[model samples]
Target: MLSDLLMLAAAVVAGRDIVVKAVRARTVGIDLLVSVAAVGAVIIGNFWEAAAVTFLFAIGHALEAATLNKTRSALAELVAVAPDTAVVLRDGEQREVPAAQVRMGEIVLVKNGAKVPVDGQVVAGTGAVDEASITGESIPVEKAKSDAVFAGTVSRGGFLQVLATGIGADTTLARIIHRVEEAQDAKARTQTFIDRFSKWYTPGVMMLALVAGLLSGDVVLALTLLVIGCPGALVISIPVAIVAGIGRAARDGILIKGGEYLETSAKISAVAVDKTGTLTEGRPELTDVVVLDPALDRTELLRWAAAAEAGSEHPLARPILDTARAEGVAPVGVPGTVTPVPGKGIVSDVGGRRVLIGNPALLEQYGVTDDAGAAEAARGLAAEGKTPMIVAVGRTVAGVVAVADRVRADAARMVARLHSAGVEKVVMLTGDTRLVAESIGRAAGIDEVRASLLPEDKLDAVSELQREGHTVAMVGDGVNDAPALATADIGVAMGAAGSAVAVETADIALMGDNLLKLPESISLAKRTVNVMRQNISIALITVVLLLGGVFAGGVTMSAGMLVHEASVLVVIVNAMRLMRRTQGSTATPRSRWSPARPREAVDA
Candidate 1:
C-alpha cells in the first residue's frame, strides 16, 4: 500500500505541470503541505504513511460530496416550472418561441394545455388557471379579461390571450427562484467559523512544521505533523452538515430562506403568532346567514350577493359562490361595469335593480347605510369564534352572514408537543383583525398575537422583536409576506400549500401544510448542527492527541493513520442522526423575561 501511494503521488506530480509552478509561487495550501508530507514519508522509507494521508483526504472528500448531494437538493423543485414554449402573435403570424425569449408586452396565445408565459392580464380570452402551485388554493380559478395571471400557472380548459406585463426575472416564478438562490448563497454561522479559522490556522501549522524540521534535522517528522494538522475534516464538516440539514428539510417540503434560520431557530425564547391563516385555515366559509327581508330567503340573498361579488376579486367571494351554487340558485347576470369599495364590498346592478353588497362604510359613503338589525347577532357569533362579513342591499341591511375558517385540528396538540420538546416559545403570526386574531390564538395555544398589519407592518413587527434582542422566525405564504420572510431571522415558507414566491423566498420550506411540522424541521436542523460540532471537535482532539504521542517518540505512521480513520468514522455516524426528526422540536427557552405584550399578528 505504501509503495502504491508513492507511485500515485509521483504520477500526480508528472501529470500536473502546474503543481511545480504553484509551489514556486509560495502559496503553501493544504494540498501542497500534504504533498510535502507524502515526500517526507518516502525519504523515511515509510511509503504506507504517504499513501494513508492521501487516502484519508480522499475519503473525507467523498463523504463531503455525498452529504452535500443529500442535503442541498431542495432547489430541484423549481425544475417543474420549466415552460417549453409560448405562442405569440408576432407581426400577425402566431409563432412559437422558447419561454426564455418571451418578452413583456407581447400578445402571447396560451392554449388550454399551455402554461402561462409571464405575469400579466388576460386581455383577450377567458379560462380558469390552476394557481394552486403558486397560491396553494387547490382549486382552479377562473381568469378573464382584466383578471391577473401568473407565469408558470397551467390553463385548465380555455385558450387565453395574455398581454404580458411582467416577463423574465420580474415574473413571480422567477422571483421565487432568484430568492432561493440568494438564500442558499447566504453564509451561516458554521461556515463562517471554518472560514475565519482557516485564514490563520493553515499558516500557523506551516510555521510549526518549519520549526520542528529545524530542531530535529528530520524533514519526515515535520511533514508528518503537517499532514496530521491539515484540518480537512473541520473545513468540510460544517458545510456538509448544513447542506444535509437543508436537504432533509426540502424532502419534507420545507424551504429554509437562508443560513440565518439555523442560528435564529436555536435561540428564540418566547413566541407570538397571528391568528388567521397561521393558526386557522385561511379559507373563509359561510357559517350562518340572517335574512332581514322575509320576501328574500337566505338562498336568494346569498345568490345575489355572490353574483355581485363575482366580478370583484376577494377571498371571501368563494364561500358565497360555493354556497349559492350548492343551493341551486341562478346567478344574477354580470354587469358591464362594477365598482369596489375598499372597506365596504362591491356595488353592481343585478337582476335590473341597483345591488349594493358591502359593509356600512360603502353605504355611508353614498349616504344610504343600514343597520339591518344583525349587528347584535354578528357580535355574538364573533365571541363564539366566527368571522362575520356584513351584507346590505342599498341603504337597508339585507343580512349579515357569519364566515369563519376553522382553527386547524392539529394546532393545539402541536403547540403542546413542541413545548414538551423544549421549545419555550410557540407563536403565530397572521394578518387578520384583532377580533379574529385573538379567537384563533386562544384556541391554538399561541403565547401572543400581533394583529392588523399590512406587508410592511409585518416586516416591522419581526424587526421590533429582533431589536428587543430576540431571535425570530416568520412563517407566511403570500406575495405580501415576502418582505417579512426576507427580514426574519428564519423565514419558513409553507411550501406544499404556499405561494411560489413564499417558498422561494423562505430560508426554510415546509412540505407539509400542517404548522406542526415547523417544530419538526427546527429540531432536524438543531440535530445536524450538534452532529457537525461533534464531528469537528472529535477530529481536532484525535489529531492533537495522536500528534503529541508521535513526538513523544513511540508512534508509527501506520498507527497514526488508524487513529485518524477511527475519528472519521465517528464523525460520519454522528451526522447521520439528523435524518430522524422528533415529532415536534424547537429552541431552548431562556429565563430572560421579554415583555409579553398581547399584540395581534399584523399582515405583511
Candidate 2:
C-alpha cells in the first residue's frame, strides 16, 4: 500500500503542468488525453499502470527536446560565432566596446587570430582571413587594403584596420542566422494538412474511447485505446525532417530559403546562367596584337594605344596597359588631355599628336580613315570572340589589339554535372554580343544562347522559359541580374559571401565560389524531399498498425505507449541521415573540348 501511494505521487509530479496547461488553454491536445488516461488508470486501482504511463511520457518529452535541439545545432553554432566585442579606434585611441555599439565609418582594429567584428572595407594593413563562417570555404583568403571583409570571419595572420560599414543585426552573419531560423520554422504544404488532421484526430480518438467503454463496460480497454492514439509520431515527422535537411545544408555553406523553396528546387528543369562572371572569369586579359602597318611595328602600336588609355578608366583599359608594361613599351606617364568618345573609345594627346584607340565607329566619328586595313583586322579579331580596339596614329591605322575574358576551368564540367544531375537544359544569357556569347556557350556545353540582353531582357528570357513549362533557376553575381534572380523559380546567388543583400534576398545562396555547388544543391534538395516523404509514411503506418492492434485485443496500455515512443524515435533517426557528407560531393568530371576543332566535333 505504501509503495502504491509513492507511485501515485510520482504520477502527479509528472502530469500536473500538462493538466494545468490544458485547463488554461481550453483546448483538446495529446497531453490532455495522456493525463486523463493516467487518472482513469489510478481511479480503477491500477497504480502500476498510472506510474508507468506518466513516467514514460515525461522521459519521452525530455528526450524529444534534447534531440530536436541537436537537429538545429548548425544554426546554433552560427549564433555562437557572432562577435560580442570590437576594438575601435575612437579619437585616435584604441577602445574596446560591444560589437553592436561600433558606429558606421569608425575604424576597427582586428589583430591576428581575432574575429572580425563588423562588415567593412579593409582600409589599412593586410591579412589572411579564414572565412569559413561566411563563405563555407575553408582556405584562408588574402585580404589587402580596399578589400571587403565580413563579420564572423577570423583574421589568420596579419593585422587590419577596417572601417565598419555594418554592425550588429545589419551584418551578413546576422542575416544568415535570421534566414535559417525562418526556413526551419516555415511549414511545407504536407505539414499543413498533417496539422489539421492531428487536431481533429486527437479529439475523435477520445470520443471513440468513451464509446468503447460504454458499449463493452471495459474501463481498461478504453484507457488503452487512448494511450495508442496520441498522434505523437505524426505530429513531429515533417518538422524534424525539415530542420535536419536545412541545418545540414547550412553547415556546407548552402543557404536554402525555406521549405517551399526546397520543394521548388527539387523540380528545376532548366538553369539560366550569366556568362561574364558565371561561365567566364569577369576579368579580361590581353590576348592578341596584330600590326596593320608594318612600318609602325608592334612596340610602336602598343605604345600609342597604351598612352591613349593611360588616363582612361574603361573596363578594357587595364589589360591594354598591363600588356604594354609587360612588353616594355608602356607610356612613361599619364596622357595629356584625354577625351572619351562615348560608346566608341578614347582620344588622347600622345607625344603632342592625337592618338585614337577604339572601334571603327570612333575613327568615323573623328573623320580618321582606316587606310592600313585596320578595320578588316578588327573584324577578324571580333569574329574570334575577342574585343578588338583599333589603334590609329594621326589618320593612319597602326594596328589592332584584342582582349578576351578567359573561361573558368570548371565551367564546362559544371554543365556536364548539371546534365548528370537531371537538369534538362543549361542556357547561357548575357549582355555581350552574339559572337562572344555563342563562343562561350559552345565552350561551356550550353544548349542555348540568348545574347545582347539588357538587364530587363534577362527577366523576359526567364519568363519565356516558364511559359514553355520549365522550372528555371537563374544564377548570377551582380546587381544588374537582381530582377531576373528574383523572378525565377529559384534565385541562386553565386559567390555570395561578400554580399549581404545576396545572403538575405537570394532563394539559395552558395557561400563559396565553386560552380559545382549549383548542381549539388539541387541534388541535395531532391534527396531531402524524398526523405521527408519516407518519414511521413513511416509515421502514418505506425499509427495505423498501433490502432489496429489495440482494437484486435493484442495491445495493452503500457505496450501501446512503448510502440508509440519507438515510432517517434524511428522518425527522428531517419531524418538524421541527411547530416552525413555525400560521397563524391566535391569531385567534378572534366568535359572534353579542343581549341583546334569546333565544339560540335568534340562534343558530338
- The TM-score obtained by model 1 is 0.70
Highest lDDT against the true fold, candidate:
2
Per-residue accuracy of model 2 over 275-345 as CA lDDT, tens digit each: 87678777778888888887877788888888888998776788889999999998888888898875567
User: What is the Cα-based lDDT of residue 526 in candidate 2?
Assistant: 83
lDDT of 2 at 233: 82
> What TM-scores do the predictions have?
0.70, 0.87
Clashing pairs in 2: none
Give the clash count for each candidate: 37, 0
How accurate locally, in lDDT, is each candidate? 0.64, 0.82
